[model samples]
Target: MASSMLKSAGEIQNLIFSQNQKLTHLARCGRIDEAVKLFESMPARNAVSWNCMISGLAKNGRVADARHLFDRMASKNLISWNTMIAGYSHNNRVLEASQLFDEMPKRDSYSWTLMISCYSRNGELERARWLFDSMPGVKTPVCYNAMIAGYAKNGMFQDAIVLLTEMPVSARNMVSWNSVLAGYTQNQEMVQGLKFFGEMQEKDVVSWNLMVEGFLQVGDLESAWSFFRATPCPNVASWVTMLNGFSKSGNIDEARRLFDEMPERNLVAWNAMISGYVQFLQIEEAYRLFGEMSERNSVTWTTMINGYIRIGKLEKARELLDSMPFKNVVAQTAMLTGYVQCMRMEEAVELFEKISTKDDFCWNAMISGYAHCGRMDKAVELYKRMPTKSLFSLNTIIAGHAQQGEMHKALEVFKQMRERNTVTWNSIISGLTQNGFYCDSIKHFVLLRNEGRKPDPCTYACGLAACAYLAALQVGKQLHLLLVKSGHVNDLFAGNALINMYARCGRISSAKQAFDEMASVDLISWNTLITGYALNGFGRETISLFKEMEVNGFRPDDITFVGVLSACSHAGLIDEGLKYFDSMSRDHSVERVAEHYACVVDLLGRAGRLEEAYKLVTEMPIKVNAGVWGALLGACRMHGNPDIAKFAAEKLFVIEPQKTSNYVLLSNVHADARRWEDVDRVRSLLKEIGIQKQPGCSWIDIKKKVCSFVSDDPMQPGATEVGFVLEMLCAHIRNTEIMPWSSLLDCG
Candidate 1:
């Protein structure tokens, strides 16, 4: 009976050992569900089986499941504790790993190293170093290597080198040497990297690959190729690096030559070559290579699909997507982005719904597509449905509403956001400025500073623009000082904005000063100052500046001509204005739009050549717009030409029937000519149209605050004080002496 019982026990022991081995293999292969089933059904379990399951679950991104299995282990050993710590480390749960490390009854080198590595990977290098120093016994090479890698990864080259020098001889291996070398190369310090590479007595293919990659990254292709050729035995990775370098630099022919000459090609090399072609819009070559490949992974299929999408062959892209053996979220997202680029939102939506698992990127892409197409309602609906809201998504939504002129919606979204970055603040400030809420834009800019968010160049530019519209010179100067302090005074965008602000505030000289001080100037700079001179009635200076602008080799755009012709109009230089207008098409090749034509009409009208101006209006090549007719009517009102005024008004009525100024100008023209019946008719038509005239409004900055006043509206703050000041000024002007021009000339 004893012998029979011993025989059955031996069989049972063999069965358990075989089952443990099978479970370990299955877990390592990433068949987590099958491994779980097998684990649960095991007739008897051991430590190896349990540890294998935990490791497998963690490696497959099921950390919670691994922890649950860990807590239920019947008898835990050193290896079991180490494996659980490794699981937390691998999954980036540093806090959990550290907590578990502290709870360990007995710790080993592996446990300490795992905790250190977890901190290093998550950018908590200080904690990593602390754990490394506090390790109980003599450190192993693996532990030393982990600490050195953490230093190298975070750009602490000095610390990594010092640690390498202090490492014991047994621990000072190729990995340690390579870690320091990679630090220099990855940070673009190739000179130091090359110096270090030469110092090493032993170099591997990885070391050579780092040098080649470093050169390629900095756009030094010639140097990269030189290093590549000097490599004693270049691996597939070496050849692939050269291929990618040449292809990215628009030298595809060389890449192909190198590719064909490669002794052995891996799947990575093939994918790299294919991606290079796609990047340069050489889709046909990419497709040909895709066909020639005998082996392909998911990357290969996705690359081809993206290639078709890049060339706008969406149908082909979809065909490949459907043909993919296994569709991942990345491939599907690429197709969705393609549809969004083409504004095919419906197709994008359909594919978006088909994605079985949606990531943050997938959600943002769909929301961006809807927002870009001005479908905010749909975007918001999807945003509400998003499982996790990221900062980028919130910024996208805010920017979308602001772009579509939905300020209230944008502000509502902005206020609802619990956290914001510089981009978030910039979006709202820029939106408010663009939508003509200048005061509010500046107010937000101030609030941004008070909140301790340093404004970028764009924010400063937006603030300057608001000051320009409000003619708030004091506030503009303050922003300029702040911009200079921020070290962005030489920024092209900010400099141009400063010029515009000074110009609009009737400070033409200050505008010129800002322009002259700029380190560099583009066409917009020249145009801005020229327009400033014209708007301020400095006609001679405007003409001189235009000639100087051309002499500086800056080609004049249509906007330049607007400033030039407007200068001539304001200065009553009719002939010069006509000459410039004619030269627009002949000399400059600039097509004359309605604004140009309007300038010419104003030129003639101001010079009392109404007949000539009227003829030009009838004969201009481009169709006349409201601006052109408005210019004619204003001129008629100045010269009391009722007939031309009537003609201009009739056209204005058809083009902009509800414009209050057009009606007002026509009525003024009739009244100036003592044509009461005509005036009455125009006024009657204005009343019939039921177009309430927009009240004339103006703004002035008082003690750094922008105050607005509407004509004949008395509800503004400090209205009584303002009225008192205005009455006193008018009375003083009436009581002052008036001198004749002849007397003034005698006095001069």
Candidate 2:
């Protein structure tokens, strides 16, 4: 190249930029060999020539070659530096990018922003923030947008919003608007996201895409489609975003329609459609798409396997996994979780052992599987034996412990964690409340505040559940006030929790107020309030509320059925209960579970139709668990029919002979038949085996401290007062149809 550059001006066979342009075209076309041949023929080379070659090399992933070419350049200008920096940044060479940035002859705002963006792309968020603070105030929108996008990507929505607020609107650009809109979407503030989006009249492609993405983020598929229709032109991104929103919104038919109509399909578009089917539990559609894809990447394969796993089509997931030409941690974890979640623990462990490498996500995925499947021991064992720990892994195992009623162990892990974030705290609190450590969870909630940490919605949700568990209206009110003061009253988790707490504590009006005041309600919010209404014997109100939820465009899930079916049973609406069961499958596409069938049995049994209840249980597709059989048996006992009661009891006993309720229910059936000999035999068998019921317990939280009391235990702080309160409540309920037994447990 230098030898050719020694030619005289008259000997120059080509114009300077003409030759450079040809070289750029060659490089851009990835004809590196021919580009080099042309480069060597150049009579002269300048900074632009070197930058072009550098960019080509970097773009082609020849970062070392690009670096060598950069170093060998005789003179470098600002363009040269920017070009090289962009190449390294694009190639993900963050350290080299930072080195180049530090050594640049002159640094402008683009230089600063580009470097910051490099860090952000690499997920070095703290490093990006450091660069952001060091930027000079000629600070362009690019720089702030980079910082905002960085924050948003890392889930620091508040930080992103705060910076967006402090920055002047005059400095706003499309990138800036996109970042803020995306930040709001990621934080689940779809309304505000749209507000910011609609406010952007001077929009570009990214601007329009951001708004569509915001609607998609909140499962507002109709709104997203409306926007997509209104757009003058839609890009691959817009089409895919709309399709994905539809898919996730449980409109797989709409998703397929959009996918089929796409004019041009990129890999992203392909992945989105595949992922959309999986999200909707349309496993056949997802797998069909996966098979139809002529060119499938890791994402497509991973999506198909995950969809199959979620739908309990583990065989299909394994087949896809085995057939995949490319396998990664995501696929491996998906398979492992499939087995673990389905309670095939041995198979999951066998697969896990065969994997050579496991990332933090892999560990967490496995832990999550075990936790969800109720194999807490295995989950705990794996967590202890994990070679590495991440915040995700720790939080997952902590949540698993909480799920399994291992509050003490969960707290131990929380206390031992090197890094404790909000999720960790939330998991611990949730576990405590879920495991019946209500007082302890409430104490931890106060302790969290005392430690200068503000509770997120999940935290308040757990605390509110604790209050409900304890039936503490006073404590619930205080937490409510605290939530209002903290300005998180609109949070779905907090609102739902407050509703449950107030309803359970006999403050139904307050609960309704909290529920009505909520700006946005999720499925859980509706379920909580509906269930509260049912528990309060407001069956008509429960049904009406459920109807309203659907009218407002919310889909009812399994939990919703529990409330509605329970309402039906309590109100003797046998016909209504059966209608809901049919609708659950026919209209809502919700599969009827044994619990649902059990609710139907309870409804029939309460109406004194033991034969109908028995027929329904026998016709159930899945195994009727003890709960279902027990309901039928209880109905038999109520009707004083020993034959049917014995039948239901035998089924329940085979499932769990050791369950005290099964024995107690059998005894009651026999006693109702005047089978005194059988009742005595049952009493002797229980005493001989030393099988005793676990005592009922209650606890309270006072000023961030836990105090516990059992029905017969006297070690609690306010044992005497608790005993007195229980006796008084018992006396008050003595004249009611139901008997009061301090030690008796309610299955609900």
Candidate 3:
């Protein structure tokens, strides 16, 4: 054919057709420059020729050059204008695209679509909506699909659903239906998403894939598998979603079986399996799968690197990272994040500097690393230098400040944040509670509710802790009801928090009821219940529960021992206290900390064994903290042993020099022993140091109002009537011969 064509000039004209075809091929392959050279070298050009070259240039992101070539065209068509507008929109030059959209001489449905897609992709929903509503002629389904997709992508599930429902039957297609379903799933409304899926008239492969993914997102593996089995021709996405779901749900065996049985596997499928093994800390399985991968992408290498990092094999992670053929930003970010998680901030920072192109995630990793390491100054310094800040960065900085007890700085960062998430509210509330600002924590919790940020288990746990510490029973019960209504009571963490609140409020029965109602109980649940019982002076019940804990295959932890020892000490069960204290390391393998020693010392002191308590404090292998000596001093006061009281008080002053309670307890001990001279000496020492004792106070919640009474409190409303009633109660108690009322009458 080439020989015959060479023999005739007419046949040689076929070179024009061949050359145009070459130009189209180059443009399609994203070689726009080559296409331009070919187009320029063409001996002649036609309208189809110019349109092909212009489309190639615009699609390849050469918008400016595409526009220049478009202007050079002697005659322009609607396709030319649409190409230019779409080029600008796709490149994120929305203003240029909008200007071109307004300037188009004759617009088609495709022309409107180009503009709508631009606004939708850019999250300019209002502009997209206006364009949709003001479309010059009848709207196309593609136009509606683009707008619905944008709403779904932006997490506006309700808006997307409204538009889907309002759409004409002619315009509602599979893509539109899938977009709404995906929107619900993305927003975590899995139940609604599933319901919508059930109502779909027709389901395609994409629809089935979305259903599988939606069920996986909600941790409903049985439903996810049901969809997976129903899929007519499962694509790579279908298999990968199920694999990932199984892995996340801790069904690693099922994930592996599906991975091995997949008819065809993509890079993402391989990564999902590797990630699943890593998530469960099955490093050996992950390693085997990594070696077996027929082909590997950057994700495969990075996944293994992260797997090693998660298992504390940082050296292995570094080795794999160094061996990577192409270290992309994602791989680098994974390693940086691994180092940050391991508390290796110095190494993370070193790697961060080595990254040639730093993304927001890289900067966030460095900031979060410094924050976790307790270097807030460095975190703030790096945060200020970030060229652009995301909500994640802002949240990390806020959490960093909260961790350091800098509530002011945390609040400042929070106020600066353009967006606040559940984590942001959690950080503030939890920080306030941890730093002993219970009322402030509760106040922020209310603000969180008012702001419409739904509280998760962590938020409710923090709020409940504040209630427990503040003894805000009314507020605590309200939150408890919220938990019950929200079904958060089924969560072990929230249930434990409920027990803690009830116990701290002296409602031991309520605490026990919560403990009994839990469907599943962890060691924390057992410890919380035990601690609550001990706090409310149910010593025998506390001991009985501890026995039950051991029988239930739950080993005692440090907190458990603290509660048990306190129960024994308060109830004068000296022998039981000694046995548990000695058995801490032997029976439970929990090494005794300072609090444990303090409990035992207090136990002995409260049992009238002053000499034994002092000897134990002096001879303990661990350092005697002020708490241990403080216990001994209080015991000396109880038993009227001024000599030992003086010794313990001296140790207390040195250990905690400014502790006013040390001096006061010593003075009280001397007064109990009728040693006026020693009491005077202690009082003079307190005056010399300019120390003042904080007055003890009590509070009661009456009709949801907390009324506080301090020593010698100023007369409040109805004080005279309350005093008269109290006097009558004291007289009745005295008349009734109640033994404990004598001390109360003497105080009145």
TM-score of each: 0.65, 0.63, 0.75
Which parts of model 3 have CA positions greater than 4 angstroms off? 1-132, 135-162, 183-196, 205-233, 341-344, 483-495, 512-521, 547-553, 573-576, 615-619, 694-748
Q: Per-residue alpha-carbon lDDT of model 1 for 1-748, expressed as tens digits? A: 8886554766877877898888777666545567788889987777888888889888765777888999999899988888988998887777788899999999888888888888987778999999999889999988988888888877788999899999998778888888888888886778889899999878988899899999987668888999999999999999998999999988999999999999999999999999999998899999999999998776788899999999999999999999976566678889999999899988999999998657667888999999999999999999999875767788889999999999999999999888899999999999999999998998888888878677888999999999899888877877887888776787789999999999999999999999999978999999999999999998889999999999999999999999999999999787888999989889989889899989998999899889988999999878999989989998898898999999999999999887788888999889988999999999889889888788889998989998889988788788899999999989986897543122211212
Question: lDDT tens digits, residues 1-748, model 2?
Answer: 9987586665553577788899898776555656767877776877788888888777755666778888888888887788889998987778789998988889877788899999987778899989888888778878888888888876677787788878889987667767877777776677777787777656676667777777776556677777888877788988888887777777878888988899999888888988887787877877777777787766787888888888888998899899977465567788887887777878887888876556566777777878888777777787787764567878888888777777777888888886677888898888888888888888888777767677888888888899898887667777887788766788777888899999898777788889899877789888888988888888788889999999989999998998899888988777878889889989998887878888888889999998888888888889889889888988887887788887888787678868888778778888878999988877776777678877897777999997766776677666788778979989977766442121121111
For candidate 2, what is the lDDT? 0.80
lDDT of each: 0.87, 0.80, 0.84
Model 2 segments beyond 4 Å from truth? Answer: 1-144, 148-177, 188-202, 219-223, 226-233, 283-288, 345-350, 353-356, 369-387, 449-457, 477-499, 510-531, 539-748
Q: What TM-score does model 1 achieve against the real structure?
A: 0.65
Better of 1 and 3 by lDDT: 1
lDDT of 3 by residue, 118-197 (tens): 99988889999998899988888999999998898777888888999888998899999988888777655678888888
- Count of steric clashes across candidates, in order: 0, 0, 0
- Poorest 10 consecutive residues of model 1 by lDDT? 739-748
Candidate number achieving the greatest TM-score relative to the actual structure? 3
What CA RMSD would you report for each candidate?
9.9, 9.6, 9.4
